[model samples]
Target chain A: MSSDVKRLSLILLFSPFALWIVLLILLPHIGMVALSLREKVAPRVYEFGFGNYIDFINEPIYWNTLLRTGSMSLLVTALALLIGFPVAYYIAKIAGKRSRGALFLMCLIPLWVSDLIRAFGWILLLRETGVISSFLIWTGMTDHGIEFLYNDVTVIIGLVYTVILFMIVPLVSTLDGMGDDMIEAGYNLGGNSLTVLRRIIIPYAMPGIVAGCIVVFMLTAGSYLTPILLGGKNSSWFTEQIYDQFITRFNWESGAAFGFLLLAFTSFVVWLGLRLSGQSLTNTVART
Target chain B: MARANTSKALLFGYQAYIVAFFVFLAAPLVAAGTFAFNDSLFPSLPWQGFTLDWFFNDTEPKLGMFHDRRLLRGLYYSFVIALMVSTLSVAVGTTNAFLFVRREFPYKNFFYILMIVPLVIPGVILGISILVLASNVANTADDRFGIELEFLRPGLFLVVLGQFSFITTITSLVITARLRKCDLSLEEAAYNLGAGRARVLFTITLPFLRPAMIASGIVAFLVSFENFNTTLFLVGSESPLTITMYDRMAKVGSTPVLNAVSFFLMVGSGLLALISVVVQRPAPSE
Candidate 1:
C-alpha cells in the first residue's frame, strides 16, 4: 500500500473514534467541570471560583443528602451481592446444561424491560390500595391496606430489584468456569459448603464480585427514577438535588458541582473496591 | 448418615429458595400485566369483570394507549430516536472495533482507557454535561455570532447524541469481542487471491461481523428506547414513552391505560430479547 492510501485509511478509521471520544465524551465532561467552577457574582456575570463546592459544604442538607445517597448505594450493593450469589451458584454449578441456559435467560428477562416499567410494576403491587396490600387485607394478615410506598425500605427493595441482575450475570459467568472437582475436593478434605465457599469460592470469584459490586454501586448511586419514584417526598437522593438544581432551580453551576461530587465519590469507591479486591479495571470491565 | 441427611435437607431448602427468588423477580411484572386487562380504571382491586377496555377503549374516561395521541406520538419519537442512536452507535462502534483490533497507534492504551470512561459515567452526568456544553456553545453563538443553533437545544437531536455517546461503548465492545476471534488467515488468502482491501472488508470482514453488528444493534435500540435519565435532561417539548410514562406515574398516579402500555413494552422487548439470544446462541453439533 502507498503511504497516502495508508494514511487515508488510517484517518478514516481513527476519525470516528476521535470525533466520538474527543467531541462527545472529553469535551462535555471538561465543560461540565468548567461550569461547576463558575461563580455567579452578579446578573449575567460570572467568574471562576469554588463557590459551588463551598456552598455544598455549607449546606447540611446538600452534604447530608450526598452522604445518604452514597451509604444507601453501598447498602444496595451489599444486598445485591448477598441475594445474587446463591442464585448464580445454582445456575452455574448445580443446574444441568439445558436448564442452565434457561435459568440464565430467566435472570435476564427483567433487565430487558425498561426501569420505568419495573418501577411501575412495584407500584402496582406496593401502593396503599395496591395488590399486595389488598391481598394482606383479604388474608386477614391486616385489617386495612398498608402503604408500602415512599419509604427507605421500599426504595432499597426497588433498587435491589433493579441492580441484582447485574450482580448475578457476572457472578454466574465467573462460577461457570470453576470446575466441579474443586468443590468435590473441598468436600473430600472434610470441608463443608460454607468453608469451601468462603475459602475457595469467594477468593476465586473476587474479580467478578468486585466488578458486579462496582457496576451495581455506580448504578444505584446514579439511579434517579427508582429513588425518586419509590422514595417520593422522602427520597432526599443527591441526584434529586442535582435535578432540582438543573431543572427546577435553573442553577447549572451548583448542579454541575453536585454532578462532579457524585462522579468523584463513585469513582473513589470503585477505585477502592478495585484496590482492595486486587482486580484490574480492564478485567473487571470486560466481565461486565 | 446424619451428615448425608443434613446435606439432603439443605439441598431441598436451597431449591425452595431458588423458587422463591424467581417469584420475587416475576411478581411485579406479572401484576402489571394482569392489571392491564382488568375492567376497573384503577390498576388494582377486586376483579371487576374481565374487559379489554384498557387496551381498546376510546371513550370519555377509559382511553386506551392506542387511542392516546400523546403516548402514540411519544412512541413514534422513541422509535425514530432509537433507530438513529442504534445506527450511529453501530457504525462508530464498528469503526472503533477495526481501529482497536487491526491498527497500532501511539497512546493506544490511553485511548482504550478513555473508551471505557463512558461506560462508567452516570447517565445523568452524561446528559447534563452535554446539555451544559451545548448551551454554552449556543449562548456564545447567539451572543457574538448572532446565530441560532436549534439542534444544540434540548431536543430529539441532542437526545440521540447523548444516548449514542455511551451506547457506542457497548456496540464497540461486542464487535471487538467478535473481531478478535476472527481468523486473519482468511483475510490474507483473500488478499493473495487478487482481492482489494475494500473488497475484502465488504465480503469477508463485514460478513464475519454481521452477527455481532445485528446483535449489538438490537441491544443499542433497546437501551436507547428504555433510556430515561439521560433523555430527561435532553428532551424538550416532545417526550419519549418512558418519559411520558414517568410523568403520568409521578404526577397523575397509576391508571390502567399505563398498565396497558407496560404490557405492550414488555412483550415487544421480550421478543427482541428472545431474538438476540437465539441469534447469538452457538450452533449445535461438534
Candidate 2:
C-alpha cells in the first residue's frame, strides 16, 4: 500500500478508538473529578473547592461506611483467594484432561447468570422463610426459622460466591502452565506436600494470584446489588452512599466526589496488593 | 510407606473439598430453580406438588412472567437495549482490534491502560460520571441555545450509551486477542494474488475475524442484558427486566414468579454461552 493510503487507513482505524476513549471514558471521569472539586454555594450556584470531600471525612457515617466497605471487600478478596486456590489447583493439576474441561465449565456456569439472579438465589436459601431455614426446622436444629440474610457475614458470603469464579479462572490458567516435574523435584528434595506447595506452586502462581486479587477486590468494593439485596437495611455499603447522593438526595456534586473517593480507594488497594505480591500490572494483565 | 499413606489421605481430603466447593457454588441457584415449580405462592417450605402456575398463570395474584404485560415489556426493552449496545460495541471493537494490533502510535501503552480503566472502575461510578457530564452538556445547551438534547437525558438512549461504554472495552479485548493470533502471511499471500487492500480486508481479514466478532457480540449482548448497576442510574420511565426484577425482589421478597423468571434467564443465558463457546472452538476436520 502507498504511504498516503496507509496513513488514511491508520487515521480511519484510530478515529473510533480515540473517540471512545476520549468521549466515553476519559472525559466523563474528568467531568466527575471537576464536579467533585466544586461546592454548592447557593441555589443554582457553585464554587470550586474541596468541601465535598471534606464532608465525606467530617460525617462519621460516610467515612465509617467507606472504611467498612473497604475492609469488608478486603475480607471478601481474601476469602475468595483462600477458597479458590485449592479448587483451581485441583482443576489445573489433578483432574484428567476430559474432567478438567468439564470442571472448568462448571466453574464458569455461575458467571453466565447475572449478579441479581445470584443474589436472588441466595435470598431463596438464606431468607427468613427460605429453603435452608425450612430444612433446619425439619431437621430439628432450631425451633424457629433463622433469618440468615442482612448481616455482614451474609454480605461477605454473597460477595465471595459472586467473585470466586473470577479468582478461579486466572488461578487455573496460571497453574495449568506450571510443570509437574517441578513439584516432584521439590518432593525429592526432602520437601513435603506443604513445602512443595509453598516453594514451587505459590511462587509460580504469584502473577495469577495478584491478577485474581485485583479483579475480586475491585468487583467486591464496587459491588452494589449483592450488598443491598443481601444485607438490606444494614448494608451500609459505600456504593449505597453514592446512590443516595445521586438518585435519592439529588446531590450530584457530592455523588461525584464519593465516586472518585471510591475509585481512589480501590486503586490504592490494588497498587498495595501488587506491591505485596511482587507483581506489576503488566505481568498480571499478561497472565490473565 | 507411611508417607505414601498420608499422601493418599491428603488426596482423599482434597477430592472431598472440591465436592463441597461445587455444592456451595451450586446450592443457591439450585434452590432458586427448584421453587419455581412449587405449588405454593411463597418460595419456601412444605412439599407442595409440582405446578407451572408461576410460568403460566395469568391470575390476579399468581401473575406469570409470560402473561404479565409489564414484565414482558421490560424483557422486550432489555432485548432492544442489548441489541443496540452489542452492535455498537462490536463495530467499534473491530476497529479497535485493527488499531491496537496492526498500527503503531505514540502513547500506545498509555492508551491501552486507559482502555482497561473502564473495566476496573465501579459500574455505578461509570453510570454517575456519564450522567453528570451528559446532563451538564444538556443543561448548557438548553440554557444557551434553547435546545433540548433528549438523548443526553436519563433515558433508554443513555442506558445504551452507559452499557456500550464499558462493554466495548471487553469486546475490544476479545477481538484484539483473536487478531493478534492471525497469520499476517495469509494476508500477504492475498496481496500477492493481485488483490487490492480493501479486497484483501473484506475477503481474508474479516472472515478470519468472523468467529471472534460473533463471540464478542454474544458476550456484549449478555453483559448488557444482565446489567443492573449502570442501568439503574440511567433508566428513565421505562425500566429493563433487571431493574424491574430488582424492584420486585425488593418489594415482594420471595415470590415464585420471580423464581420462574430466574429459571428462564438462567436457561437463556446458558444457551447463549454454550453457543459462544461452540462458535469459538475450531471446526473439526473432515
Top of the candidates by lDDT: 1
In model 1, which regions exceed 4 Å deviation?
A: A2-4
Tens-digit lDDT string for candidate 2 (A68-137):
9999999999999999999999999999998998899889888878899899899888987888898899
Q: Which of the numbered candidates is closest to the native, going by highest DockQ?
A: 1
Fnat across every predicted model, in order = 0.73, 0.75
* Per-prediction TM-score: 0.97, 0.97
Q: Interface RMSD of the predictions, in order shown?
A: 1.0, 1.2
Instruction: Summarize candidate 1's per-residue lDDT along B1-286 as a digit string, tens digits.
Output: 9989998999999999999999999999998888999998789889898888888788859998889898899899999999999999999999999999998889988888788778888899999999999998999999999999988999999999999999999899899989998999999999999999889999999988888899899999999999998999999987988998888877778999888998999899889888888877766851
**TM-score of the B chain in each candidate versus the native B chain:** 0.96, 0.97
- Put down candidate 2 lDDT per residue, B103-214, tens digits, no spaces: 9989988877777767777898889989988998999999999999999999999999999999998899889988998999999999889899889999999999999999
